[model samples]
Target: MHAMNRRLSMFRSAVPLALLLVLLTAFHAAAERIQLDIASSGVRKLAVAVPSFANGSGNPNSAAGKDIARLVISGLEFHGFIQIVEGSTNGADYVVQGRYSSMGGQMMVEASLLDTAAGKTLPTRQFRGSAAQQDDLVLRLVDALVEDFTGEPGISRTSIAFVSDSTGSKEVYIADVLGRNVRQITRHNHLCVSPRFSIDGSKLAYSSYHRGNQNLYITDLNQNRTTKAISRREGMNLAPAFSPDGRTMIVTLSRDGSPDLYRMDMQGQILDRLTQGSGINVSPSFSPDGSQVAFVSDRSGKPQVYVMDIGSKRTRLLTLQGKENVEPSWSPKGDKIAYTSLTSGRYHIFTIPVGGGSPTRITSSYGDYESPTWSPDGKQIAFARKRNGQMELCIIHANGKGERTLFRLKGNQSYPRWSPRRN
Candidate 1:
């Protein structure tokens, strides 16, 4: 009996030890990292090969297959982090291939990412939608592929809101990152500007002159597109910016005969006055932590950027070099603030550290850049550029490289506001 008891104790100890070993091995396998050098000059871009998707049904050279491949390539290249190259079987770090089929008015797509070094393909991801959703499905697949390669999802699903004059009047319009699904949000037919999204992206607030005054209004995007006036203070109600929590907004109101910043609830009830007659304070942007705000003020004789503490109400000047600075946008990472500065007779985009430092100019061209907006990941800046008497939308990397036109519309586009990352 003593020998039997000893054997039982030994077997129990060995079982736990074996289970631990299995768990450790599985963790190590799952934690393998993909080396992507996004910051190094040695490798400016990751070499990727995206061949034409194979058609599982219908014609082999179907337009649908070609369209899917084109969109996937465009979406990946738009981020400026990856370069889509040729030669699928050789000289590529990663390869993307997919198959598509259409049946009963529904389209299905299956795609896989291949690691050339490992000589293995990742598990296939499948998506199904109607024929009209072809572009959206390709965007989803590209986002997934980005995650597999960089461990961070791409911004293909995000959207941007801006003011355009396509309908012979300045109105707000929304479009995807790739400039598709363009929809006009307002049809005031007079003048509408400064379209700002709520933190949850379910609503948009702006000021319009259609009602014969600069009044503030909010539109419920999730509901049945109901629009309501939130503020009709009589002087100027413009540039509404939501806080990080979406409970309150900081807007420039001149109801009392002086333009100042006021924090108000969603119903336009004034919660507290942030700036008490501080020299035309406007364009408030909340920090990521909701502890501070960056805005533009002309209290010191010229327009300059300033940072203010919400708790103490202490303000500090941020831009010292530029004679005129406006439209301060706090970075999502809470480290920097991007704004527009006038230098050498032209408006340029510049970024300065949140804690006060020399501003670095991100735009150097002769065109005028204004109303800079940061992406959700804080990696890019979108702004309006005007040249040759035409205004258009442009984007530049945070590091000041890869400047390119974001979209080409019939009319001028200005005041771009990027949406937060979707679930």
Candidate 2:
């Protein structure tokens, strides 16, 4: 683990007693509260079965079948209307089968989706790719099959932006959500992390250590026109939080040797310092209504989540049960905040009601899972999972079921923020 990852590991052991008390109280309150009983009805969940694909000419020990099937099923599972049937038993609403082929210096994959109930073919699609990436071609076809069943475009149309250092420099790269179209976004022979999209989705802001210092820079992604530095403070100008209205941002800076939260305009003008003397404040997340901010700080002890009223400067601790909590991402619906917690020496994503409640664990994998970012529709959470020394981005339904791997790039991928749907 890197130094930052190790710091997270230590936080799980250092939470305070007072916070634990608050968590117990909240749980009791929830148990006592009367809740409405709505009519019981369930959405028809389609079961999808993807059989292992035959590799035409590749390493027999490769992970092609599982990787492609996982990526495709993940996109369907995120929509919350489908369930991926594990194994090869073939008892499912739909079954997909595919094979790889190479011709004319290019690799091609052909796939077909069959309606198991009716025992007939429903849809078929073909994908072409570079001869070297034959497996990726199969995954893309799987995405198309998912779209045909759901009537909604699959995540294959979307791409993930992440940092990778396999080439010896930690630069940002954008790859298809299924791990195709792996294009380098930054060639700045420097370290770049925390890539975020602007409200319009045409610009990106990220922290870079390219100039021998940690600074914030914005790039017009469409035009490839780069802007001036947003912040170049002496220490740790990182974690930019864009406002919902798209006019301002809240960023963390450590210029004074203590990381504190600051609200800044889009043009890099400092608006106000919402926190002061709070121990190592970072990860500022604006509420859905844009009235308050949720952040992580080590003020009362170890890192814990705190919510601050934007106007009154009053603060309240949001997380009380966990020994360490960080990476708070407020839901777009404004009712809850999702974050990562270190419990039992493993990092997992959890969510608490913004009004206060027992934090619900969203992931229970044995690996270190952190950085929970909500989809714009507030129905899914994308996060980074470190399992077996390989780091990959995974998405789970906000309802706490249907976990699937979004993609597995060459290096560690973290800090996923979904873009709002464009008109």
Candidate 3:
């Protein structure tokens, strides 16, 4: 056991986690305290008026204010829960009014949410940032306004990690939810895939073949992009899903001569062996509370999704309708699991209830969709679509609508993993 732990080392400190938890706790505590009926699930999209922000202060930067407003409108609309009304606030459910000022390379912006019928101004918050990082400031204000209305922060601040072969070799890359700021995370010059973000959004883990082995490695993205091999096992060290608290992860390791799921802590210490040498167990995803795990296995002569009780070590098959299923990603809400199913020789995205139900097809296009990953809010899914011998990362609403291309970069992109909302 000590040798096993030594083989799976890490490159991180404990200080950052403590600080992050404190900030996240405070953010949750200050969420929308006033109940709004329109924010409820299954409710109609709330009509909101988002006129141009006024220029108020030392420097008259009305263009900057308008730019911020435009981006915020696009961000809010992308969430699929807000309907922006252009002209009048008379028929709108709420109004977002704001002002911005810039002086000496710094920007200050404030915005307030107004309940039109109640004639009440909700919370007004001021965000400050350097002129160069104005996008961050604008997104912060956007999330604050979203929480003021929906009791949850908007996903505009989140990022998605994917594998691409742009450099003639598959490498991991990350980009904002808007598909801007595309940054390559790995330069292995060899195949690397299955990029997963820790629950805290501070760390990323993926497997690389640059060192002549498919070894698992983790990178502290919050740190100075330091990468470390947490598992250098002889064989498969594949996809890992972090637990909700970010302290532990369920990773597929084949060190014992057969691929199986193993529970390991952040420090690379094995906590428990979750699966015996089952028939090629892989692609494990943890439930929200960490009480269960959803994974793909071929124990019954075909690849299928199975849920395991973390306590009792008992497992149950979740998908029986598909000939082959792979890449089961549990929803952040803990109610559904999104995965890829091979149907009629074509791969597509599907979701099934956590309590056992028929799978609902989420993609019905001509392309083959694989590796379905959920957005932080569970409202959108990102997957890889293959058509015409080319592959690209694509996204769709949770209900199989609003499908759009997410990336049009140089090469075939696959194995998308959505990150949590940034701090």
Candidate 4:
């Protein structure tokens, strides 16, 4: 377990348009065909096509190639497995055909694909950057055609990390998954929140109060000022999950007074302690074979949603009907566990079955949704709702069906998290 020099340093949310086109038509209704099993099933769809996109640099009938083929058909119809067919390609099974160029100031784009049943022509991919990273060359040609028809790859290249007070404070930002550039990684002008990310997404830990100590930092998204802190001891160096192989991390320290859940690393040390003071153990996640850990406990009297098992430290009770469950997450194929329950007093989002079952409701509207997360290919989810008082950041489709609005910015945005699809 000897490691260091794992640097990173780049940190970078928004929502709104007809109520965001009725939430981008429920985020393009997710899938219609490609359910490789579960991440909440109900799949199928691949009509494809993309009609406009061919402007070797001029106006040869290319309004920026029909706006880069409507941003590659709205980012491969929001990654549920595509369906955007218009004008022709008869009943598509794929068509894509791209092109773009912009001299010296840089901007490449290529693309190709085709094969409406062996009319063949595969392998193509160009890309190039800097035209303000035109959505990073259409999310790398729509996540390289969804990793050439799903073998994996296409979280539109990935990036999320949230919490924004629109600059009056609550810093810590980062955006991308088609929500565009938007950086600003904690100027710590005060309150910063959760933020996780690291398992090859470079690094980004987070949990700040700026120096008054709510501590726990880590920033490095590749290098431009480096963040550090690691776990400034005191009363609570909160949130941090990481651990799918980027070394170790479970986090949620109360500096021994009680908050619980430890087992850190990647330099922040403290390698053990998995919950002890009896109650309050914050949001920790993991599982996908890190041996287990879902988190958010109230020790069994109230706050629910547990899991734990990291080497037999045993624990259970996973929200049996929620009288208030907290923020669980864990679902990059460890089967399920979404969380954020509550019920009549507001809050929504659910998901059960991580070897258990029951809880389903994935938010049916009415406002208050909480800090959910997931989506390093576990289909989708990125929460934080709130209503008339603002707060944004949304996305769905982990079988809660499509649902949209994931970009637009103003005075409120909360926890988010995402990141890890940058291979």
Quantify all predictions' global Cα lDDT against the true fold. 0.78, 0.71, 0.78, 0.74
Give candidate 2's error at residue 74 in angstroms: 8.6
Q: Rank the candidates by TM-score, best first.
A: 1, 3, 2, 4
Q: In candidate 2, what are the lDDT values of residues 340-370, reduced to their tens digit?
A: 8878777789999999989999897678887
Largest TM-score belongs to which candidate? 1
Task: List the candidates' TM-scores in order.
Answer: 0.87, 0.70, 0.84, 0.39
Q: RMSD for each model, in Å, please?
A: 17.7, 10.2, 8.6, 17.2
lDDT of 3 at 52: 78
Q: Candidate 1 on 150-169: residue-level lDDT in tens?
A: 55678888889898998899
Clashes of each: 0, 0, 1, 23
| Model 4 C-alpha lDDT versus the unseen true structure | 0.74
Q: For model 1, how many clashes?
A: 0
